[model samples]
Target: MSIQLYGLCETHSSEECNFYCRVCMFALCKECKKQHDIFEHEIIRAYKVNEVASFRLADLESLRDASDICPYKGNGRLVEVIYKRGDGIACCHGQGNVVECESCQYRLKSPSAKYCSIQCKVEAVMKMNESESVTNEAKRKVETISEESASDVKSFTKRPRE
Candidate 1:
């Protein structure tokens, strides 16, 4: 299709423009395009959608790399990529930077942070403390029950008390 100059570029609002920012949906001219590029805005030549069609991935991927083009049928653009350092998969609906905690399997907000939340960290500590207490309780109950049984056996051995 042909690129139309609706009016002055959106960036400078004074200079003539031929290109448009796809992400922000703003128009930009040749001179403004250079300045907008520095900011890293995703821009594309505006084209009129004269026709729409239903297609499959096999058809689209064969024409061009699937990664370069959005798999969806209508968008006709590349998928936005968010950078991550770790091998762990992303969290927050595949948008934010998050990694699962090794201890609780919860997603941590920051890649560098260790735990997801204060509660998970607290649960870890409580488990340690609870383990010590639970073991001690079990030992005490065993000793008490054994003593009661031993007393009953001694009473049975004795003759009838007159």
Candidate 2:
């Protein structure tokens, strides 16, 4: 059973098919699978069931009312199937705390994220470095003036008062 023939997605030519849409009877990549999910269409792992008999059995199983539950401890929420990052499923419940990006103030999806995206993170770091450079330049100027004033004071103190 070689799925190499159906490896690439028809719609997304550049992406490889990871899921099979039973209703449409075609293979789908991770991005194209989202539409089928919204329509509540039956979807299965492309590698799991490529044969005609397996598709029929999967459809029969989908007709049941059984639902997938979260595997995390103490969280009994229903699981949402995620195809984008492999076959991993996630629970709907979040930690209740929201993280905002430091530069743009945009809401962050990842819990440990300091910025919303790579662009924002890069911009924030650049600005911080720029300010530090300006501050360093100003400190150098002040130190130079202080050293010149000290030299002048030493010359005045050494001269006898005529």
Candidate 3:
């Protein structure tokens, strides 16, 4: 069978020499072999061309599978998980700096806990205060109502039969 090989340099003794290094598994040409001092006496061995090709094909297939099973493709699941655990949010650009907002749930793009705008920050703080106040007031009202109801029940039960 006839095979056309592109990019293969025509040189003598090409068949005798391995296509790649057995130690590093890097593809090498005939000139590279002499330059690197690779010989039968050399400690390092050379891998066959077919073996190197098979290894590369396997690596490509594994990479494709890994990309398919990756969880943080579009959802940024890894970042979200880290942020939810209070470890701070990582920059979208893969920087080590983690962005977080102390006053609100909004994540910043920098180390500073800044919102998109000053107004948004202020509104967030105000909303937080308002909600806290409402909760406290409700608790106070419930306690007062309970006390009044208890007093009324006591007085009604203590009334003599007249």
Candidate 4:
């Protein structure tokens, strides 16, 4: 009496059907059956079904309690960009005399004027003339009062009472 093995294929033979090995779970042809049986017969061991079920249940519980939020989220802080050495102008947030151009909005290092272009420098100076005039007038008024007060004090100190 011979038992027929179902789904055994050998290279395009319609009489042979493909089947997976019970041990290694690899598809085997009729010619490869002997090679799979040699390895499978040695490693046939019974496993506890209850232990496998408990392990899978623990994995599912841990996955359910796991956090979805990222730990590194919003951790980066804003940093100020520093200018190169000998650039004469400090950074935009630093104590530098350099500024952006009002007309073109270009950032440039300037010691005397806030603008990089000659036209912008000239315009800035002209626009600032009114404030300069007011400052000069205030300084002159203070100097006049100081001088008059000094002379009055000197004259009073020099006079002798009758």
lDDT (Cα, 0-100) at 138 in candidate 4: 100
Question: Tens-digit lDDT track for model 3 on 2-73?
Answer: 111122534643434333443443444566556656454222222223222112222223232212111121
Candidate 4 Cα deviation (angstroms), residue 148: 0.4
Off by over 4 Å in 2: 1-96, 159-162
lDDT of 1 at 44: 51
- Predicted candidate 4 versus true structure: per-residue lDDT over 50-134, tens digit per residue: 2210011222233321121111111142111111112333336554555555534446444332343333433455678988999
Give a tens-digit lDDT track for model 1, residues 76-162. 642211111224443455554556654455454446644432233334556878999999999999999999999999899885889
Candidate 2's TM-score reads 0.37
Which predicted model would earn the best TM-score? Answer: 2
lDDT of 4 at 66: 13
After superposition, the stretches of candidate 4 with alpha carbons farther than 4 Å from their true spots are 1-99, 103-117, 160-162
The TM-score measured for candidate 1 stands at 0.25
Which portions of model 3 miss their true places by more than 4 Å?
1-96, 100-117, 160-162
Q: Could you report the Cα RMSD, in angstroms, for every candidate shown?
A: 22.0, 18.1, 24.3, 35.0
Q: Which parts of model 1 have CA positions greater than 4 angstroms off?
A: 1-99, 102-119, 158-162
Ranking by lDDT: 2, 1, 3, 4
Model 3 clash pairs are none
TM-score of 3: 0.31
Pairs with backbone N, CA or C atoms under 3 Å apart (clashes), candidate 4: 7-17
What's the lDDT of the predicted structure labeled candidate 4?
0.39
